[model samples]
Target chain A: MTRLLPVLTVLLAIVALWYAAVAPMNIRQALDMAERGGAVVVPEGSRVRSETSVWTLMAQNTGEIARGYALDRPRLPTPVQVGAELWKTTGEMALRGRAFSTRSLIYHGWITLQSTLFGFALGTAIGILGAVGIVYSRTMEMSVMPWAIISQTVPIVALAPMIIVLSSQLGIEERAVPKAIISAYLCFFPVLVGMVKGLRSPSREQLDLLRTYNAGGFASFLKLRLPASVPYLFTSLKIGVAAALVGTIVGELPTGAISGLGARILIGDQFGTPLAIWAALFAAAILAGALVTLIGWLQGLAMRRMGVRA
Target chain B: MDIEDVVVASDLSLTFKTADGPVHALKDVNLTINKGDFVSFIGPSGCGKTTFLRCVAALEMPTGGTLTVNGMSPDAARKARAYGYVFQAAGLYPWRTIAGNIRLPLEIMGYSKAEMGERVDRVLELVELSGFGGKFPWQLSGGMQQRASIARALAFDADILLMDEPFGALDEIVRDRLNEELLSLWDRTGKTIGFVTHSIPEAVYLSTKIVVMSPRPGRITDVIESPLPKERPLDIRDSREFIEVAHRVRDGLRAGHGDEL
Candidate 1:
């Protein structure tokens, strides 16, 4: 709850900014557009035309002025028009299920969320296990680690489409599996490096204490190594979740047909109405922020339970 | 009990396999510590005093020689929960509360829940930390932390205690208080103690027997028996007998210094 305060404050500020800048300005832009018979005109060298509201003024140009307005450029969405459109669309697309309803966003969001979680979990597990394996065994360090580093350098963004096609070719028919795999690919590296560092975090002196107690391999690892890794694990998991979300979003962008927030975004994007695109983008941002906040809360709870202050 | 000697080290030797060379840390060292014996081993920096204590605690294995306490090897003795070791640092688990830190060995040794609670209470009281069980290690002064660590070791009710410069990290006033408290605790419980310290005054103030040693291939130089009365006062340090023994320890150290080369 304490953590939510800052986020809420930031959100309120953004809302205020929208009210101040986009809300009134976009309404004025729309009014001016409607006034000028839906074509914008910028009276030359007007100081008001030179500010951030320049885009709004440019839409007022007869044909060839302002940054975003042109005979060809997509219209700058006024705050009122977007708000009204958002309200109307929420009624049509979200609340009442008109064209491209928010119910679809919810459904796609659920699918994306499930894949993100699964992929993040799978990646963290793999990374932790791999880190443990590498830390304990010099042989694995020589043989497996370099290849793992090399694997990450390959552009997963480019390979995601190939992975989808390849998964089908191999008769792995799960629709979300390919996307989840790509998310997994994005997540595991941070976990790998972070877990390795965490697992090895126990100082030489702490290990010496265990040694004095005759604590053998597994005993020392469980009592000391594992507990120490917790903070690192949660931190990595937070990063991993964000990366997984990114990977899933990226995965959706390439396919252009899958069911996800990302797919919804791509669909809304091509239509040229910034409101639809902005809504999708805003929803995705909210989801990522919430997910990160959840991980952060867990981190605090675990650290507190372990008697760690921070 | 035919033998009240709780610790017996015979011809102990250790050679470390270092990259630079085989470092001979200890050679043919022998010592016997009886029940309630406050024995301190003091030496130069690279001397085997700490190493010897470690060997006795089974933290380090001897390259040669046999060591036992209460007729058992240190490792076997440790498994039986026979000794509490206080390291140079408090070695308190930073994440555990004071009482929780004290309870660690008891937990490891598998005491009943009730027994563990009783034991923790007693040790916390023993160290004069009657009400500080909930505080973390960082919250305490260095002396208090070390005392808490000693309390942790004392919680086990082991027949033997090993302390490696436990007071070395403390300032003078706290160290003096702890030394007095330790002596009183020793007088009360009759637990055999094997302590390692570099501080001359600490050794003189605490030990029944001081084993003086020196560096290059470390070896015991002299075993000085302190004759100060059992009922020690802070002013006892100013006594002639105490002064004599302190002088003897200094001379022995000087001799050991010469013997090193």
Candidate 2:
């Protein structure tokens, strides 16, 4: 991390230069025609700008801006305009119930979180049980494993609407179970693969040692295999939680409802509220980060309990 | 406990069929271990010595003959908890503390908690590892870890012990000291032991009887009774009697390695 600091700074400097350079060329070219014989090189309907600011340059730098104004786009939004939008939209949303209250985001976020937690729980149990079955039985390894892979191959986003509609037909619409099922579908495969590998991870020499003790299959698993698998299981669980959250949000989109991060985005688009969209996106990300961190904490606790050298 | 024949293997043999054909691992291997006998099996690599020890410990099935311990089949004897085994490597569970590892067999055998506590202390002290019980296996040196493994084998006070090159990975100094200590412990506890090694000097120094094995279709080459006195010390290696037995084991190994020339 110490060595990464200079690299990050260099990257930031390059980004800043690119932000400063691109729009100046667009704005300079736009006004160059108004100066003398310079034909309006930029197409009509492209926003006409007077002066180029460093921050505004970033927004206008897209190649589409160079072609004559046919590709009509908003002029580089001044930082003040963005800031003003952030304040007004956030302020109105906050003041809906009380001053500085984000009741809408809170309620919708709670709904999404409920679905994520439910889905994550379901997925973890299914994955662990599936992995155990696969490792212990040849029939499961041959039959269930291929089906698990096939299930993952179907794009979940494409299946989300079908799942939602089917679940509504089956009367799970108001229960959050549909979103949870979708989350479970997305989160289980990694945990399943990781756990099977972890359970079977102990070396052959170790197994022979256990055999020397006359330990049976169950005793061997309890004494050695289970303890050895703690690290891999927890790592997969953390990743599974994040996937569960993403799946829940995707699940919300198919439902076409007004809740969760997905719902917030939909509402923002319906009302032309970019501020709402950005705030909702930030909130969803923060939620996912929090859930993943929680699993990481659980992982540390589990490894310590198993007496494994971290 | 009365001192008597602790193990008797009668014409034991093992074979397995592989992709190529049937492979014979051990042939007509027979040995007897009486109480307090520190019997050593010495041979070159691929001599099937380790496999023979595993058979006595009930870890492998003998395809041809019977292995009896105190007049019971190895499988029944194992269920009766008649012996403890130490492997070529320590094989200590990295997740367990040394004390916990020592108690594993006791735990499986349903020994009382108090009994386990007492036996853990006794064996740890026997191996001169009195204060190292709480440390995890990974935290210990190779020699110390092997010592812990030996202590684990002795934890239940079984009548017989099987060790497969248990100290082969240790330094010479540690190995010599451990051999002396092991002999003293045997004399004190009167536990019959079957030890396997490849070093001629180690075999000559440690054994009451040595069963030499030949490879490539492993079979017994010779069973030589050591001429060294029942009592052994560090200086025994310098004694004339020790050198005679060492030379005999060397000749036995040569014949086993297929260099009659």
Candidate 3:
């Protein structure tokens, strides 16, 4: 409870500040809309306030402030508005027998999830293979590691479209493959670096002891290098999974895929529905959180079984 | 091809070519360790005691001369699993249990599961750590961990044991106790043992022969055979024979230092 209190307090403060900013941010548009509807309009820049108090100024512009918070297409959606949209898209939409419907977040969330998982799996395999190559061979370490680092510096947004287009030309029609490749590209570096470090983590004494046993290269790798890399692999895997999700979303954007959460966000932006964008953003955050938590659970189980403390 | 000479090094030299300069870690090192002999190499920090031990285990190759173990090349002896090596620190794999650590060499040697289990149990009992098989290396005390390391080395029942300062990290009381236990273990096993240490009393107490070494191109100054009886107690350190042997080792070390100036 004590640990949670500080986090909850900070979250509440952010929500309160968000609510307070809604009025000032959208007030000008609200007043202009009122004027266009032939309502009484206070031109605030031309008029001087009788009292400099904030409450008095707010009282004078109550109707306009209310309209600002309740705008159908706000530039910045209030937390409550975003919350309502989420509830409507997920809970209300599901209750109304359209759980898998186009309007439902659950439908779009599932679409994004498939690509994210595929990308994560591909990234892990690439990372492990890259790490093993680097550890086992001096040539691979010298040649491949620098290129892998250079690959990460190129922005995913710029590269995603190129990858998608090139892949399509190569007769790869499935949209998820390119996205998975991009996700794998994002994730592999951390796993590679971590595994390399872990593989080399054993002491000289330990290596010498293995030498005395006359253990072969493959036997030593399986017995010593691989088990030693587990904790490090999991740490990289957590980072990789999150990066994979970001890669999938970025991959979705340039392709203009209309099925995933990234597409939902792009659609909401085009229609100027801030609430729609915010809901999709929240859904992506939730999905990433769940994926990372699953990795953490796996890490706990594996590490515990290996007698490594959390 | 002498059957009694378990290890024979003739004019063995190892030079490491670093970016700074060539470090002559061991130079023209020649020694013979016979079967069933407890030999301890006592020296300063850079005296190549560990280097010589590593060469015997085939972990390092001498740049010149010949070094053989069990009447064969060190590499061939290593391939035959002729010796078990215990390092300075108890280098137990943290992820493995005490029994798992002990079973490591056996597993690599392709021993059957039943044999591996039986040997792990027997060695654990031999080391007086019978119930510690389930515990991780980190869970045990430093002395206990070193004992576990010894048990690991003993698991395969090899003809020779190479140990490099196995108890150097422990407290004095723990060191003394482990030394006594090691003497008894050596007596029981009859394995030819090469131990390296910095302590004079430990050298005098544990070995049938003590090799005094000096730094600056790492070579043996003198090899002193112990005049004391094989059956030694902890209180043997107070005896005249033990002190006389300890003084010879001290004299050999001092003589080597005087030659440097």
- Best candidate (score: TM-score): 3
Residue-wise lDDT of candidate 3 within A1-310, one digit each (tens)?
Answer: 7779999999999999999888877766666667677777554432343223445545676876787887888877898888899999999988998989998999988888898889888888988999899989999999999999999899989999999999999999999899889888898888888888988887777777888899999989999989988999999999999999998888888787887888899888888888899999999999999999999999999989999855
- TM-score of the A chain in candidate 3: the value is 0.91
Q: Which stretches of candidate 1 lie over 4 Å from their true place?
A: A1-94, A97-104, A138-144, A268-278, B259-261
Per-prediction TM-score, chain B alone: 0.96, 0.94, 0.98
- Candidate 1, lDDT over the whole model: 0.79
Worst 10-residue lDDT window for candidate 2 chain B reads B1-10
- Candidate 1 recovers what fraction of true contacts? 0.24
Candidate 3 - CAPRI tier?
Answer: high
Per-prediction TM-score to the true structure, in the order listed = 0.83, 0.85, 0.95
Instruction: Give the number of the best model, judged by DockQ.
Output: 3
Supply candidate 3's per-residue lDDT for A189. Answer: 82
- The lowest-lDDT stretch of 10 consecutive residues in candidate 1 chain B is B1-10
RMSD to the hidden true structure, all candidates: 5.3, 5.3, 2.9
Worst 10 residues of 1 chain A by lDDT: A65-74
| Tens digits of per-residue lDDT for model 2, B1-261 | 223778887788999778999777898887788877889998877778988888887788999987888788888888777888888788887778899999988887778999999999999999999999999887789989999999998998588888889888888998988888888888888888899997888888888899888887878888998778878888989988888888888888888776533
lDDT of 2: 0.79
Clashes per model (N, Cα, C within 3 A): 11, 4, 0
